[model samples]
Target: MTANPARRSETSRQAILTAAFDLVGEVGYAKLSIEGIAARAGVGKQTIYRWWPSKGAVLFDAFLALMGGGPGDDAALPDTGDLAADLKTVLSATVDELNDPRFDEPMRALNTEIVHDAELAAAYAERLDLPMRELKRKRLRAAKEAGQLAADLDLDLAIDLLWGPLLNRWMQRGGPLTHEYVNALVDTALNGMRQGAPG
Candidate 1:
């Protein structure tokens, strides 16, 4: 019996992603390496190199897999026609995700590097942040179309307002990340956008 090429390829890819994910959580991004991942995955280093150009790329793919999405996929966010409810749901999940030590520590390590490395930050934005933001923006645009938001909402500013405080709380360690806190943030941002003049 011959092994299916597609199945073998997928199995190897999954192993690499899982190894990268667990290694990053345990040893963090700086200590994570292709050799370590290959050894852990029981695959040759050449296998990983053949698919992904760098460890960062593999790690990013792992992160995407962890989020239950693929590169540039944003289907994780639900659309229920209620902006406040939807925002609260998503933001609350984000709060919980950030609170997980496995996710938090690795993300912090990656973010630290991105902060210092402009090129890496640009790549990260292109690969991760921009797609996520565009999804959120799409939801906001839907809300505007439904008259749930002001007609002339400046979506970029609206997005910043929606996420800024949450990001601040996450980065500054100024407050606890709670469902209640995310709800408040959503309310405040939505109310502000409703009342404020369009930019």
Candidate 2:
């Protein structure tokens, strides 16, 4: 039997999402709008509105989908049991992803949206940042449990250690994302900012 027409409609919906994602990545979110998305997707404005409430919603979902975080789905962070190792594995991959020329444009666009639109910022937090942050927390707690981390170590501090340098690296273009760089991050995080680990 042939596929249902609803499935075909869903396919077109996905096509619209793809077009929005690509166009926003190319032109930037400021220039991206529902009308522009329609033109790019070859769909009608009403058709876009039939499914989404705003351009921010579409672009937010589009970026998530591109990141393998489709509707009702969350991206996996990593759970390899070895805390430093697992964090290293996931963060190393993230470093490489962030450093990619392909990702920079969309990320900059999304960053702008985060600042400009309160609703979009909330949507982005709900869909993307919070889950990733929770995953990082879970891993750090696990590391504490495994005795790989100091029992007195603060998870919040651990999280800062994990993300802070990466943020600096991206904004400052401080350095490239490399195995050596990631290893150094892990070491610096575990060792402390100004002093060596307790002897």
Candidate 3:
């Protein structure tokens, strides 16, 4: 029986990602290093270098993996043609993610790195934020075209308005990220965007 190189490679890659994810949670991003991850993952520094350019890159990929969606999934937002329901479902999932301890601390650490390092911030936007935002924007544009939203609705501003407060509350530790709260957020955003709503 011959050993499979491809399977071995995948195993090594997953080990690296898991090590990075765990280390960021344990040591925080500022203190994490390639050498530390290599030691934890039981691989040499060359193995990590073969796959990632920097610790931030590794951490970003790991975080996305932990979020239940890798960076390459091209699926669009669920469009059952009901914008309110879709938005509520998405926001409700976000609330659950924010409330999960396994994800919350690691995400907070990565966000802190994003805040302090401009290069890392740009990479995060390029890898995750911009793609997801564009998908949501596409959905919003569809809603507008379908008459579910005002024709003049600014999709970009609408996205900010819909998600900004939730992000603030999640990141700032401001309040409980309850399912009811996310539902309210979706209703408020949609009602404001609906036709004939007061500005």
lDDT of 1 by residue, 22-127 (tens): 8988987778899999999999999999988777778777777776664344264678887899999989888988999988866776677678767667778987
lDDT of 3 by residue, 1-199 (tens): 8999999998998899999999887887778999999999999999999989889889888977775654356668879998988988888888888797777877887787788878889988887899888888989999999998998988999999889999998888999998889889889878888987886
Question: Arrange candidates by lDDT, highest first: which order?
Answer: 3, 1, 2
Query: Which of the two candidates, 1 or 3, achieves a greater TM-score against the reference?
Result: 3
Name the candidate that leads on lDDT: 3
Each candidate's lDDT (Cα)? 0.83, 0.77, 0.87
Query: Higher TM-score: candidate 2 or 3?
Result: 3
Instruction: Kindly list the per-residue Cα lDDT of model 2 for residues 18-127, writing each as its tens digit.
Output: 98878877887778888888998888999999989887778777788886773333545577875567768877887877877767767767776678889889888887
- Candidate 2 has its poorest 10 consecutive residues by lDDT at 69-78
TM-score of 3: 0.88
Clashing pairs in 1: none
| Model 1 spans with C-alpha error above 4 angstroms | 71-76, 116-123, 195-199
Residue 48 of model 2, lDDT score: 94
Q: What shift in Å separates residue 1 of candidate 2 from its native position after superposition?
A: 7.7
